[model samples]
Target: MVGHVVRKRLYILVFAALIGLTALTTGVAFIDLGKWNTLAALAIAVSKASLVVLFFMHLRWSSGLMRMVLLAAFVWFAILVALTLSDEFTRQWTPVPSSWQAQVQQQAR
Candidate 1:
């Protein structure tokens, strides 16, 4: 059937996208982006994942329910990242042990 043929082509496209993504990620790792390293990697990963979800997973032609499921997943992922970063950044304000402070003070003197 034509649908089957088209689906096969889509599969090949998805495979190519995945291979390109891998190469891009490898290239990115060699670049000294400093703080942007993670951002770059995540960007490429998200792009590659989007392609997979859209084409390979057939979400592009999926029903509203499927779209909602994908949206929910993304929302949950964002929440997790936000909560983790909030905890990590706030940890900087936590008190250090007295012994550690004493050692720092001794070093200063």
Candidate 2:
């Protein structure tokens, strides 16, 4: 008998979990948790991504090599994000052009 018996049930459960998490994310958006709102949204997003990767991508059934590759990819992604944020955080703000500032002031009124 084949070992990897594909289960429709598992997919259904994962789908349901993703939907629930999405609803939770939507609900969280309206509440003013201030700093925690971003953290909560990020946590839920990570959970959803993990579910999609493990279940939908069948990474759970993947070989060790595949997992190592995934880990390496994550590391690379982390490096890229860190570098990007570093550049962003160190940037200098320039004064807006007079014309644009005038437009912005007009819009505010």
lDDT of 1 by residue, 7-108 (tens): 577788789989999999999999999999999999999899899888877778778998998899999999999999999988757566678778989999
lDDT tens string, model 2, 1-109? Answer: 4445668999999999999999999999999998999899999999999999998888898889999999999999999999999999999989766787789899999
Which portions of model 1 show Cα errors greater than 4 Å? Answer: 1-5, 93-109
Predict model 1's lDDT versus the native: 0.87
Scanning candidate 2 in windows of ten residues, the lowest lDDT window is: 1-10
Clashes of 2: 0
* TM-score versus the correct structure, for each prediction: 0.76, 0.80
